[model samples]
Every structure is written in structure tokens, then in C-alpha cells.
Target chain A: MKTIKGIKISSGVVSGPIFNFERGKLTVPKHFIREADFDSELERFNTAIRKSKDELTQVRDLVHNHLDEDHAKIIEAQLLAVQDEEMITAVRELMVREKKNVTWAYFEVMDDYEKLLLKTFSQFFKERTADLKDIKKRVIYHLSHEKDIIQPEIIKPSIIVAEKMSPSDLMHIDHKLTLGIITRYGGVDSHAGILARAFRVPYISNINRIQEIVSYSEIILDADNETILLDITDDIKASYESRIQDFRRHRDNIISDKVANSTKDGVPYHIYLNAGFVDEVKAMDPALIQGIGLFRTEFLCIERNSIPDENVQFQAYKAVLEKMNDLPVVFRVYDFGRDKLLAMLDLEILQEDHVFDEWGGIGFLLDNPEILKAQLRAILRASAYGNTRIMLPLVMFVEEVVRTKEILETIKSELKREGLAFAENIELGAMIETSSVLEELDELAKYVDFFSIGTNDLALYLLGSGRMTDLTKNYYHPKMFRAIDKIIKAGNKAGIPVDVCGEMASDPYALIGLTAIGIRFISVSSSALAAISDEVSKIDVQQCGKLVNSILNADSAFTIYSHLKKFYHEQLE
Target chain B: MVRKEIKILNKYGLHTRPATALVTLVSKFKSDVFLEYNGVKVNAKSILGLLVLAVEPGANLIVEANGVDEQEAVDNLDRLAQQKFNLE
Candidate 1:
């Protein structure tokens, strides 16, 4: 087998057929059709278009049945482009205007708009490919864009080598057979990089036109050493043995050491797990997590379909509770406004839409009050096994808290009247995802037993930025601290326990910053639990307290963020 | 054709989804539909035509559809105005 070398982006070893998709262009065939063949060529092109359109639909169906209308337009566009009135009519106009045959006229009209069509189709394919989660999707996407001779070989073990990819492409690649990803273009901050980290696959991006260096179906890879050995032979293998030995050393170095969370003064903080899905709960290390602090119910409502049936919802909730056993597992009810989840639900049911109509309609999460009632009723039913807390997301005002509490009270009284044993005094809380909640903390805290700061959303709202789109925005920035400072002061004043559950909580460097801001409680991912606890345990709370005071007095979020980084590095060094 | 002008209020500019929704709504009527914004007028039923208008949040636009449901067309088009193009 021939071999080629490149940088390893992720670490894994596999050998499979190489599916190299070159970003290419298609245009009108060079030679014009004769008058005799015009009818036949047009028919052929129409057939090709029909076939491609059918393939797109089929491919989409394999991944998902119902697509959002916007996504549906992509397929619609492809269909429309095939017989576009403008393109067809333009060609007809050219035929009469220039005295050219139908095929030649069609070619000339298409040729002028060829670049525009390609650009449109390319973007459309990019989006559709990102949505693809399986091979059927890849094939469909490829077929949609490339109407030429289309074929898909059954390659069980496959390796994808692409110039660059979107997040959806990386998500769809069959992780089981896909050993590694080799990209000629991308960066450490690319979605591909984020995905590689998430999938635990070794991938190397930004290899400088590395595609030309390695041919399709070439044997390559040095997974552990972060190299893609090209043209490998026994001699090359023998020579790389020393490097292979280092892999063992590196693996040993990676072996994580366990540690507990205790302050310098020996005060301990709860490092709970902030899990969303049942699978994530199963993945958590029991020894590391105190319990599930905030289970985002919104994730359960992510896909475009019917609201989860009671059994489905119960199963997911039960799975997390079962794994936690006696550990406290707080189930935060779906609290996001209708924009993300229930965009199609009736507007009247959405609470936020009454105030804002930017979202097409209130999503089911916020719009449907009955959902909260139904979900709380489900949780109350499951409360027998584990310590449970029912929390809400984006708790903005006191009235919402009162409204939810009233519903819960009714559920409790009904359970009592029915003579069923349930956890009567289960804790209630809200995610401080919006800054507005901070203003209403005095009144809101009375209803909530504790608070969890979802810095992701809070920062987005505070910065007036898009939460999903703007990833570069940091919660560790000074403005976030100001918000956190407000939360800490408000929660502390109200005597309500408060914690943070954002990606920022996963950062060890932020542990001291959090504690300094009087955020003694942190809910992190299972993978981050041990490391954060270890870091938090070592921090001098008094020193953190001093930092918090300094940060609070600082002029801006950036200044406070920079100061914290300097302090963290100093401690580490 | 009777014409009425309105504004685009959705945060995200008129893209495929909103365009499709708008076009589909107008197609329900038996009227010739047209839209004008920034001095450009195009067929309301055409996606490319609608997108080319690049109607963004806070942009004023005019709608003209003349047929059997021309008044209903104006009413539905008014809903788009009231809906503010549905971007949050």
C-alpha cells in the first residue's frame, strides 16, 4: 500500500476507502446541439434534472422527514432551477432574438447565469450537506450539486479527505468506520475542530493544500504522533519506532489523576453535573459529580417534530435519575422562548411573543403553559427515587415565577388529594439566563430555592449578540463578571444558593474567578468535573474574594477578564 | 393594480423561508402579485425576485397584487407587515 503524510487533527487509527469530494463546478456542455439532436439533448438534461431532484428528496428523507420550510426551499430551489421560468423563458427569448436553436439558446442563456446558478447551488448544497447525518445525505448532496454520472460505492470503512467542511458534514460522517479526518483547509477554531474535540477523533486541519500531496486510496496515518505518514514502508516504520515509543509516554501523561474540591481554608463547594440528554447522564462519572444541578429540558425539545410523548419524556428523566441514584438531580423545565423550539406553535401560547413578535410565533416551550404543568407533573411522579429540583430557564419576572409556582402548588395538592406519595418539598429554581432576571431577583428569589447562571445566554443578551452564532464572545469577559456580580449580590441578599452552568464553568482558570465573584457553586460537564473540583479546592477563597471585589470595581468586562487571566497564569506558573 | 406600502421588520433579512411563506400566501390569491422596495419591483411569487429585493428589518416596502383576491391579497400582505417578517 502506498502512504502519504500530513498533520493529525485528531487521534485514531483506521483504514478505509477514501471519499475525496472536490469542490467542483459544472457548466453547459461545450459543443452546441444540432437542430436534429436539440430535442434529445433537452430531454436528456430534463431527465438528469428530474433524477437529481428525486435524489435530493430521497437523501433528505433518509436523515429527516419534516424539514423547516426554509430548508424545504433548498430542495424547492433545485426543482425550480431545473425548469426555472426565467432560465427557460430567457432561453426561449434568446432563441427568438438570436435565431439560435433551442439547445444553443438554452446553453447561451444558462451560460450567462451559469456562475450565478453555481454560486447559489453551492451555498444551497453547503447548507444541505451540513444537515446530512448519514451517507445517504452525502450522496444526495453530491448528486444534487453534481448532475453528471452519479455513483455511490458501498465503502464500509471510509476516510473522508476534503478541502474544508461545515459542522453538519463532520457530524454526519459515520464515526464507527470513519477513523480520521484530513482537511486541507480549516483552523483550530473551526466547527470541524470543535467537532473533532467533541468526537474524540484525532484530526489535523490547515495543512496547506495537503490534498495534492496524497492521492485518493493512498495508505497514510500516524495517529498517535500527530503525523500522517505518507508512502509508509517497513524501513519508515522501523525508523519511526522511537516516535512510537513516545506515544506510550504521552498516553501515560494523559492518565487523569482524581482530586476533590476543597477551598484553601477547607470549605467545599458542590461541583454538580449540568447534563441535558439521557446519554450525557449515562456518560457522567458518578465519583466526580455531586449531582445534576441543571438539566436543560430544552434539549429534549430540540428536533422538529411532535412534542415528546410522556413516555419519551419520562424515560429521559428516569434515565438521569436512575444514574444519579440517591444523588440530587434537578430537572429544569424547558424555559426557552418559542424561537428555538416551538417556532411553529401558536403565538398565543408563547409568553414572550406577547411582548416580542420577532420569533415567527411563540415556541412551544414558552408558549405552552400546559407543557410546564405537564412536565412538572411528570417530574413529581418521578420524585420518589432521587432528590429532585424543578428549575425553569430564562426566568425574567416575578409574575412568571408566581404563575409556575401556582401550577406546582396545584399539582402538589392534587397529588395529596389523590393520596399518592410524592416529594412534596422538592426544590424550585430558575436559570439566570437573562439579565432582566437579575433586576427581579428580590421578588424572584422568594419563589426559587436556588439559582443557576446560564452565562451563555446571559452574555448573549447582555452583549446584544446572537447566542448560537457568536461563539467568539466570552462569558469570562468583564461584563459577564458584572452580571455575575449582580447575580451573586442578589442571590446572596435573598439567601438563595446560586451556581453557574455555562461552558465557562468548565474552565479551570475560571474556577478562581467564579469563587472570587462569590459564585461558590459550579455545575460542569462530567469530563470537566474532576479538573474543576481539583482547581477549585486549591484556590484561596479569600484571594478569590479580593479578586472579585477588584473585578466588580473595574471599569469594563474586558479589563476584569484580562486581569483574571493574568492571575490564573500566575497561579499556574 | 391597487398598491400599498409597508415595512420589513424581521431581524434576519428576507431569505428563502420567509420568502417562501410570503410567496405561498400570495399564490393563494387569483391575483398578479408584485412587491417593491428601494425602488425595485418584482414578482411576489418568485423566490429570486423576492430575495433580490433584500428586504431587511425596518425597511419600508410596497405590495401590488391585482386579481380576484386583490383586496384579500392586500389584507394578507398587511399581515406580513403586522408580522414584521417574523425574525427574532
Candidate 2:
């Protein structure tokens, strides 16, 4: 028996046979074309291009129907690349000049372009090299008739092992026939990682030489423990089988537990789920969550070639509201920036020296008033179906709030002119993420109905560390809790309720601090609802307040974290 | 032939979408449009040629168009550059 340690991206345990899927690096076959066969080879190249384009068009339509238009845009870009006049002319010229095979000619042309792009553009544009390579792979596959690694059909339920998987590759994976994912490369913030988490699949990444070590072996993936047990003995296998049964039973018990939203001391706090996709909303248990705190609208824009029209946005928003049975849902405006760029909206990349200065949240919306108006109009229209609210992200300035409110009023008037029905009393809010907003909380609160403190960004901005990075995990900072405390106090002064919808809200240790700060509403991922609710049921609000007060008086974040850990073991555990 | 010097005003400079827009717009005219930046000249109607130039914000380029619609093409392209390729 052997055990390999890896970073656990998503938490779950499963044992199954390994389906080893390797994305073999394409080695272009270099050969001189025979003088007699030159014309036929050139014809073959043209046919291959035509076939690849047809396949891409089919893939684009399929993705559009299955996922959304945004995802379809990725393949659309590839189609355009295939039809790019300059790239095609360059390849043709290379083939004619060197008398080389089609594969080698195509590779050389793409490689030269890629190198040029990498040298000239910033990292943001340099990332497009992957897309270029993706297009290259499609054409090469057509030329060579090589089967794509991620074929739709899988014979059995097995753990998918790969050297690396791209976002597009992850989208095509058959999740039902897959037990878990073990990969040699990927960060927690990768698209594959995010999808795995959203799907509640057991995933582990950065497992060195995992493909070599566990080739088609019966593997036990304990994501909770971050261990991959390989070739286990019969005795161990029996023990794990029972353990799996126990774990499932325990999970079922948690799900079935009829727990109230209030703490043991009778302090009621609201718990909502953060959803970015329709599938997440459909999977949520209404009884477990009170409402949807954050519906990330950016997800709808990421993969599409064009900005989603009002009807498309309206349908998505309305579907979530209908599924949630009229529960209070907060729709955040399209927070496009460095990570989420809309292909249709050709907005400027606003990064100054690697720092995202003004591209996220309200800035992007304000810069493009038309896009913001479309979203506001859609959200306002959807609000007619259920209880709804609008939340703006990355609001660092009071002027931003005022500008957004003005835009909202303009959209409302336009809708009124059109004689459209919308909820009259839809509330508006802003995410308290930066210190600039925190300082002006009282003034900003006057313009909005409530505040949802985004702890992930708040913590990162406060500590000057990036999220999901080693620097963030290693550093202990209590500044975020202090920021939350200040925001809650400001909300109290303004007679508004403040909620938190960041990673901190889902964390057990952070929950203690949050409750202590008098935060009444907490929004976490749906998967974390049962566990967090279970923890909330055990917490005594008064005790949490006192403990947190002492911890706050402590020196640093490290001290507060250690104190909280000790308190958890002594009391909750 | 008509020639005019202009600077890229968009925050992200001439990236993919803007490059495509420029190429598509130039292709509409009967004129042959050529852009010269820092001694490297490329056909303005070719997306790959424009992208390879990798023009950033504040870079100065001379737009030259020659044909029956040379004046109109150069004037329209200069206007597009001034408006930051319509990507405000």
C-alpha cells in the first residue's frame, strides 16, 4: 500500500479505479514534402482546415445549448482563428517556401506568432497563447485524425487522473461517470478547480508524478485528509469501506438535522448561499438556506462572445428566483475586470504595474453605462417575479454608489416609459471590501439599504496579499475581523443590517469572529451550509462575543487565530 | 494618398477586439491602408499584422491610405483612433 500527499481542492472521499487520461504534448512531425505529392498535401491541409472549422462550429453550437453563450464564445474565437486570413496565409507561405509537411508548417507559423505575442504584450494578453495552442490542437487533430483525450463516453465510474486539464477540457468531462479528479498541475483558483467545487466533486491537485504512480490502479481518494491511498490491502479496504459508509451516514444526518437558524443562545443569524450558475440554485435545499446572498452575474458573461442581452439576463435571474420559491435573492452586477473580461464589451484592461487599479465591480459598470443599464434593467425586470435586491461589488468611492444609483434611476424610468412591470421596492447594497469604502460606510449606507462585507477581498486588500495564495494562508491577520467590526458598527449607526459573503463566512473559525461582531447575515457556498449550520447551532452568541473581544484585543492576526483554534477545541469540539 | 499620424488612446491599447475592429473597418474601404509604428509597417486590414505590432496606449502611428477612397479611409481611421476604437 502507498499513500501520496497532495493539496485537497474539494472535500470528499471516494474509491474507484483510476482512468488515466494524459494530454500528451503534441510533437509536430517534421518532414520535407515530396515534389510529386506537394499539390495533394496542400489540398489535404485545406481539407483539414475545413473539417476543423466544421467541427468547431458544431462544438460552439453544442456548448451554447448546453452551457451558455459565454462558454460558446470560446469555441467561436477558435473558429475565427481558424478563418484568420493572416494566419492561414502565413502557414500557406511557410509550406510553399520550405516544402515542409502541413503539421510542421502550421506549428512553425503559430510558434513564431506566439513568441512575438509573448514578447510584446503583457501577461494578460500573453494568456491568449493557450487559446492559440487550443486552436492549433484542433487543426492538428483533424490533420492527424488523433482522438481527443476527453471522449464524452466513459465505460465505468472511475477517478480521472490527468497531468493537467484546461478549463475547456474540464467543461467536457462527464461528471456523472467520474468519481473524483487527481491532477499533477492546477491551482485552487483554476477554472477546473472552481467547477469541481461547484459540482461537489472530490478533487486534488499538484500531486507530483501522480499519472506515473497510479496508472489504472484502484485508488482511494480521501480529499478531506488530502491523501491518495493506492493499492490498499484487503484489511485496509474493508476498513475504508465501513468508514465511507459512516461518513455518508454522518453527512446525511447533518443534512436531515432540523436545526434552527439561531444560535443555542437564541440569537438568530441569517445564512444564505452564494450561487453563480443556475445549476447551483437548482441544487440548493430551500430548507437549509434562507436565501441567495450573492448571484455572481459575471459567470453569465465570461464564456460568451457577446454581452448577454436583457432577455438572456432576465431569464437567468428569474429562473433562480422561481427555483428559490420567492426567497430574497441578491443579484450582483456584472463584476468584469482582470479575471472576467467580456468579449463583446471591448473595455480597456485597467491594470497599472500588475495591480488591478480600476477594472472590477462598479468601475467597469460605470465606465460602460450601456452594459450596466442592460443588467440593471434585467434585474429590475426579474425582481417582479420574487423578492430581490441589487448588490454592487468593489465600491471604493462614494461617487461610485451615487453614479450607480443614478444609472438605476435612469433604467427604472426607461422601464416605466416602456410600461414594464418591476418590483417597486427592490433594495440596493454595496460590498464592503476596501478600506476606502469602510471609512465612508456611514455615508455610503445612506445610499444603500444594506451591506455585504466581502471578506475575501477585504482580507486580501487589508493584508496586501492575494487570495488562494501561500502568502495568504501563511499570514495571520485580524485586520479583516476589525474591518468587519467597524462595518457592523457603522451599519448599526445607520440602522442597516450588514452581512458577510466571503470565504471567511464559510470558515468555522471565522464564523466565531463574525457572530461576535454582531453580523446578522452570512452567505456561504451551498455545499458549506450543512456544516456551517451545524457549527452555528452549537455556538453561543454571548460566549462568542466575549471570546472574540479578548481575541480582538490581542496583538496580531496570528495570535487571534491561535486563540480561536484553542477556543474551538476547548468549547465547540 | 492620404496620411495622418495618431496615437492609441484606449486604456488597453490595440488588443484583440480593437484590432479586429480596425481590420474590419479598413477592409470596407477601397483604399489600401497601412500603419507604421516605430519603423515597422503592416497592412492595417490584416488582424494578424496589427496584432503583431502590439501597439499600446500612447503609441504614435502614421496611418496611410492610397486608392480612390484614400481620404475617406484615413479620415475615418483617424477618428476611430481618437475615440479609443469606440471602447470607452
Candidate 3:
């Protein structure tokens, strides 16, 4: 067995056949067209053009249906480019004049076309070079009959092995058979890695000889271990197979175990799921989860141009509430801005005097009373269906909560006047993310119902870093844990329930810190549930608290970091 | 034949979405539509044509149309462009 070391972008252990997609263009074979067969040759070229159009349309529709219109817009423009009168004429003219094979003619013309586009002064036109190159590949693939030898039929679930890839290629990944993606070159924060995470697949990169390893029948991709085992013996295969089985068994055992929400010593956790849509709740056994800690209402605003009116937003929240039924679902209202965009809003992300008070969440909402009221009315209106809570994102002070409550009251009066039935009470909660919010939680908790530690943003603000710039390195900073400990302890003192969510909830060692701090609840992405459950089962809560105490009291960031790393190795290993 | 001139007034130039909107509007009519910007004329029905023009904000674009629906095409295209493709 040959073991290759690589940088793991996201973690999981998967074993599958390697589907090699070459980064460089596949060889476009050339042929001399005979005068006698000119009609047939031209017909074949036309067939390729037609097929390429169909493929672009198919991809466009797929992205439109699955993702959002924003993602679909680029493909929509490409679909128009596919039938551009000038581009089609250039391809046919090349074939007619050169007596060259359709694939070669198409390739030569498109290659030149891409260069022509890249040379253009307009950024809009220059950006089309990538699409032009992609279009060239699609057409050439249909023209060339060599499939099995080059790009095979991706029938089974396989790990994508590539030397390098573009974002468009990553977007075209057939997620049905998507086990994972590994490449010879890419940053963990590359667009491909981001898409891989969006596609819910493990991704790794930085390996050598990606092109040479295509002949292997099957390989094991243990991203968690940062190892890709190749040319595996039967024994190695069977052992990895059992490891997969063991993972599945543990997942099933914990999911089935009613008390999986508790530590081995019977300390209960309000284990919740962080969800974006209704389907995440529908996919799970409802009894296995406590509730959704964070349900982004931004999904309604994301697709299409206009802001969803009160009723449209109301219906979306109602679906989740009815689906979850008895369980409490915290709906974060229109956390739109900073990556979550509403084009109509025309948001200029102006910096407030406070660094953490960047545009989004309560800050953005409070500025637009109409938008805020519409969302407050919807969440409160939906509350009649089931248990619901309203949580504001990026809440730094108690006053924002006060304003939202005032608006909710005003909205409630409007609903009552309009004869709209809303529940008597819908809980108001705050996401403890901003650094300022941390200091104000004691004063803040009095105004809200419960608290959720949004560690992703909390860490970002605390460390004063952007997420794209190596958050994984900064995320482990010792200051992050102390902050969580502070949030949890403050929650305990204030007599309000605090739940940990975002990245820290799933990170094993950070989870250790969280559990040790006597946090009563935490929400994690559903995929990590089984592994997290297993990690909790192994931790002796009593000892973890003692370990965390020393780490917390440490004078230096380096001192605390070393202690946390040591704990991770000793316990999680 | 019919002709009209419109200014691209959107904060962002005729980028992806607005270019798409312009192409979609011109395509609905049976007329042959063309847009002239920066001394370059291009097929109004083709998104690539609009993109290559690189119609920046405040640029005056002359549109021409010929065929059965010429007048209607010219009017709608001019209106859409003036409306900034109804986008920000």
C-alpha cells in the first residue's frame, strides 16, 4: 500500500474509485477531411454544436433549480454566448477553409477566440475567456469519441482526482456520486474547497503526481488523517472497509440511543442542528435532535431580486415550524449583508464606529424599519403554528434588542388590528458573536430569551480577522476558548440558557472546552453529529472541566494553545 | 427601420445581469436589433455583443432595429436601457 500525504481541507474518511479529470485539455485529435465526406463531417460538427448547447442549457437549468439565480446568471450568459452569431461563423469558417477535423478546427478557433477575449480592455469581456475555454472543452468532448480512455462515464460514486481545476469545473461536480475531491494543487480556502463544502463532500489537496495515479482501481481517502492510500492490498481495503463500517455503526448506535444527547456520566446537552432550510429537519429522526439553534431566514431573501413580503416570509417560516412541530426553532431574521446579499437593497457595507458593527443582522435591519417589521411580523405570525424564537445576528448592544422588541410590539399591534392570529409569546434571543456583545451579555441577557454562541463570527471579531484569511489557524487561538467560557459562565450567572453553535461546536477540542465550561446546549451541522456524539462519550466531563480550568488561567496565548493541543492529542487521539 | 439612443446609467456598467436583461429584452422581437457604443456596433440579441461593448455608466448607446417589429424593438430596448435594466 502506498500512502500519500496531502493537506486536508475538510475532514471525513471515504473510500472510492478515483475519477481522474485532467486539468489540462484532453488531446483533441486532428483529421484531414476528404472532399467526398465533407457533408458528413460538417454534419458531425453541427451535431457537436447542438449537443454543446444542450449541455449548457442542462447545466444552466440544473444550477437554476438547485442553487440560486445568482449562481445561474453566469451560465445564463454562457448559454447566450454558445449561440453568438459571430462565434458560430468563426468555427464553421475555420472547418470549411482549413479542411481540418471539426474538433481541431473548433479548438483552434476557440483557443484564438479566448485569447482575443482575454486581450480585451473590458473586465466584462475579459472574464468571458474562462467561459469561452469551458465552451471549447464541451464542444470538443462531443466531437471526440474517446471517452473511456480519457474522461470515463462517472457512473459510480468516486473521489475526483485532478492536477488542478477551475471554479466552473468544481460547480459541475455530479454531487450524486460525489464522495470527495482531491487535487495536487489548491489552497484549502480555494473556490473549489468552498464549493466542495457546499456540495457536502470531503476535499483535500497538495499531493504530487495526480496525473500518474489515475490507473489505480480504488483508493482510500481518509481526509481526517490527511492520507490517501493507493495501490492497496486486500487486507488494507478490508480494514478501511471495517473502519467505514465502524463509523456507520457508531453513528447508528448514537442516533438510536435516546441519551446520546448526554455525556457518558449523564450530563445532558440540548443537542441541536444548525439548518438553512426545512429539508434538514425533515431528513432527520426528529427525536434524535433537540431543535434548530439557527434557522437563517436569509434563504428567502437570497433567491430572486425582490424582498419577500410579510406573507412569503411567513410561509417559509411556517414550513419549518410545522415540520419541526413541537421542537423550538430559532429564526434569525434577514441576516442579509456581508456575503448574504439582497441586490435590491444596494448595500454599501459602511463601517460603524464599532469594528464589529459591520453591515448585517440587527444593524442592517434596524436601519430599514419596513424590512425589519416585515420579518418580525412573519416570525411572530408563524409562531402560532409551533414553538419559535427570534434571534438577531451581530447584536452588540442591549439597545438593538430593545428596538427589535419595540418593533415586534408595534408589529403585534398591527397584526391584531388586521385580525392576524399570532402566538401570545415568541421568544427573543441574541447570537453572542460580536466582541462588544460579550461584554454586554449580562445586561443583554435581561432583554432577550436565550443566547447562542456564534463562534464563527465571535472568533472572527475577537481575533480581528476575515474568514477567508486562514481562520483555521486563528480559530484555534487560546483567546477563543476563554471567550466561550466567559459567554457560558455569563449565561449561567444571568440564569439564561446559552447554546454553542457555529464552527466551535463541531471542533472536537473546542467542544471539549465547551462541555467543560458547563454549557447546557450546543448545535452543530448534522453531518458531524455521530462523530461529535462519539467524542462526547469518550470525554470524562469531570476531568475536562479541571483541564479547561488550567488552560483558562494561563497567562499567555501560547501557553493556553499548547495545553489545548496536548488535550486534543491525549483525548481525541 | 427605427433608431434610438439611450444612456447606461446603472452604478455597475452593463455587467452580467444587466447585459442578460438587455439581451433578453431585444430577443423577444422578430426584428434584427443592433447596439452602437464606443463606435462599435453589435447584435443586441447576443449577450456577448453587449458585454464586448463594455457599456460603462453614463455612456450613450445608439440602438438600431430593422425588420417587422423594428419600431417596437427600438422603443423597448431604449426603455430597458434607460431603466438601468431595472437593477441596481
Q: Please state the interface RMSD for every predicted structure, separated by commas.
A: 5.0, 2.6, 2.4
lDDT of 2 by residue, A116-188 (tens): 7788757656755666666676677556644233243457988888876654355445666777889987666
Runs of candidate 2 exceeding 4 Å displacement: A20-155, A163-169, A189-192, A246-254, A257-259, A303-306, A342-358, A470-476, B1-88
If both were scored by DockQ, which would come out higher, candidate 1 or candidate 3?
Answer: 3
Worst 10 residues of 3 chain A by lDDT: A344-353
The residue-by-residue lDDT of candidate 1 on A362-480, one tens digit each, is 12344455566678777887786678888777776777777778788898898789886678789888788776667788788887898888876677678765432433336556777
Ranking by lDDT: 2, 3, 1
What DockQ does model 2 achieve?
0.23
Give the Cα error of residue A70 in candidate 3, in Å: 17
Predicted candidate 1, C-alpha RMSD: 13.1
lDDT of 3 by residue, A173-290 (tens): 4566768788876655444554454345777788786865677878888887988888888888788887766644543342564425677677776677776645546666766667
Chain B only, TM-score of each candidate:
0.88, 0.96, 0.94
Look at candidate 2 and give me any clashing residue pairs. A70-A303, A70-A304, A71-A303
User: Residue A181 deviation, candidate 1, in Å?
Assistant: 6.5
